[model samples]
Target: MHSYGQFCGLAKGLDVIGDRWTLLIVRELLIRGPCRYTDLCTGLPGIPTNLLADRLRDMEREGLVRREMTPAPTPAAVYALTPRGEALETVIAALGRWAAPLLANPHKDDVFLPHWLVLPARLYLIDRSPRQAPVRVEVRDGDHRVTLEAARGRVSARVGPAEKPDTVIIGQTPIAWQLLLGKIDLAQARKAGLEIQGKTTALKRFGVRPPTKAVFISP
Candidate 1:
């Protein structure tokens, strides 16, 4: 029962997805495509189950999502965007562009390594370039392992064991983030005693360039 009243078209659009969590939920679907409830919950940590369920129901009623029962004997459901919902991708992408500056500020001590980078690195593809296929990567620290694949301007990551890749990047989360962001050079990180194992060529391949100028935002 959400209504825009006399708001402008853009304001009316926001009325449908203006809530904080709603836009984020749409962002995930737009980026990753169809997903199960569990997957959505995993990507969006800290969301309460009851609230997520309510949002899903609301979105469905609003024509932004479509749900289908899977063919499993016990039957599970998955959700995907409808055409109207899919149109939101452009808006979400614009929001990301606007937020990029805030994302680049290095002074924020609250910055934490995005879980997207770690965890199930084994099942993912990491691509630093939009033009190149994702270089395969395998990450291991103790019993944890994650694999990555990148191709066609997309990256996919999964968790599990596998053969070591050409490079093995080892560092605490903060240093890792800095390295990834180009705030710290690989040589500097190595001199600081961060472990960089595996093939030297692989190390070079995995070295991601930091953005020239970051959009500064408070975390």
Candidate 2:
């Protein structure tokens, strides 16, 4: 790891995680939990095999990652984050929040993986109607799909179709994100080619309210 040669906390933290694909490796581990080497490769397309091995080794050496063997029958090695590594969740989450605006103007060649939506879903979705019963909102983008279930004042997201979705949203992933962020209403989303079915009220439960104006008091 290359050091910034500074004694500051930020510089010290960067010294451990600032290498190319380091944080992304952390992201995969955070999203998928303990994963086989092959699983990591699958999530991170276009990464070279040797480079991944090298990064994992560096992470292990830095005490940020550890490898463990699963129980017999079909035993395999999996990589997981150490407690120290898990602490980076806030840093990764903050970066995700910071990048939300950039999604609006994606480059033509950008790769849109549906699984990446999980982070934003957790970040943005909140159960406005927490007192009400649970609601399942299924989102689809081509073959990729994810379900957002709101219940008991918390919203949880998972990949795959909901068994019995209360509301279904079919459209481009980006458009769905815009809707979830409350940047566009249902009517505008329909005009943009999204199809909404079932209880429209289900979505409102995960409401994103407009920021309230601050009152200025006279001095």
Candidate 3:
């Protein structure tokens, strides 16, 4: 951990979260809700065990995260963000908006996580509907499902099954992102073997107007 002896707030803030992957750990916790120790390890592609443990410990000390004993059907120790930590959502949203351009072209070795799309999806979602009836979208990729809700002039996405989804979009992350951004159309996405069902018209609110020419990324 890099310690800044200065008394400034930004420096003080960074002292706790400026470590290489501390904020990202917060990102996982925020996106996934309460997570087990192993869940953090799995969600983060390349984080080492010791480092993850250390970060969690440091965060707990800094009043960012706290351990809880979940009760009932699945009683287990889990980590959830404190209110102070939940405050980071706005920070993360701002960071994601700032970093959106870089996502246009990812580096060869860049690590990718499907749930990472949650923040940006919330950020970039273009809701064209006049009436906000609380649309629900389930982004399904393999065994992972991210629930998205767009209503009340806000978009919120959660990592898990939805209560009752109005539209279920099943597709690869990259293609789905592109489709949602209007870089591709539903037809093209379906042609690529995606399985989308329910309220197709309402689903268009999440995507941009399809481009005239489809842009394909080479394998």
Candidate 4:
């Protein structure tokens, strides 16, 4: 890690977390609290094992993460963000907003996860939504179910289902990403085999307008 050698808060912060996979590791930990080493590896596809180990060591030394041994369902160790690390949520959220435009043009090497949509959904979609109910969303073929709760000018996501959802979106990770980015309309996707249960109008509060259905009459 290279440091600016200057006296600045941003520089100091970057000195600790400016590496390639560091923030992403933090992001995963934030999204899914207290992850086992294997869980982090599974969530972050394509990371080298040795590099992950090195990063964990560095983060622990920087007071950004801690390693804990638990005795539940068997003995195991897990890594969780420290208080200082938890404060990075806003930074990650801001990055998600800034990076929203890039999602429209995905790169071949770019990976997608259903839970990743939650950040932008919290920023761009739910924050603007007029409705303030907790919505449970299911991402088909993955373990990325999350409930989005809109409250006080912003929305936040929690892993797992909401007690009662006004709407539920069922689709693959790619489709979910597009929907959150506003690149594709849910109604159109639904017509093309995407599955959704619940009222379409319920999403209007989130700035989602299902495409107008087209009807054809043939003689």
Please report the candidate that would top TM-score against the real structure: 3
Best by lDDT: 2
Q: Quote each prediction's TM-score.
A: 0.63, 0.83, 0.87, 0.80
Candidate 1 — which residues are off by over 4 angstroms?
31-33, 104-134, 138-165, 168-177, 190-219
Better of 1 and 4 by TM-score: 4
Tens-digit per-residue lDDT, 1-219, candidate 4: 678897999999889999889999998898878999998998798999999999999999999999998887797999999999999989986776566455555567666666655554555554454345544444453555866655555556756766667667775655654554465787766765567777655554454322312111111
Candidate 3, residues 1-219, lDDT tens digits: the string is: 678999999999899889988889889988888999999999888989999999999999999999999998879999999999999989887776666555556567776667876766666665676376888888888888888776766667778878888988887776776766677678998997778888877576664322222222322
Q: What overall lDDT, based on C-alpha atoms, would model 3 receive against the true structure?
A: 0.78
Evaluated at residue 63, the lDDT of candidate 3 is 96
Ranking by lDDT: 2, 3, 4, 1
TM-score of 3: 0.87
Model 1 per-residue lDDT tens digits across residues 1-219: 366685599878877898658876786676566779998887787889888888888899999999987787877888989999988867765565556456555564554323334421211213556575346555444444555555565555555444546556564534544554456777887875568766544333333323333232224
Report lDDT (CA) for all predictions.
Answer: 0.60, 0.82, 0.78, 0.69
Q: What is the lDDT of residue 31 in candidate 2?
A: 71
Colliding residue pairs in candidate 2: none
Sequence-dependent TM-score of model 2? 0.83
Q: What is the lDDT for 157 in model 4? A: 73
Stronger candidate by TM-score (1 vs 2)? 2
Q: Candidate 1, TM-score vs. the true structure? A: 0.63
Predicted candidate 2 versus true structure: per-residue lDDT over 137-173, tens digit per residue: 9999888888888999888887778989999999887
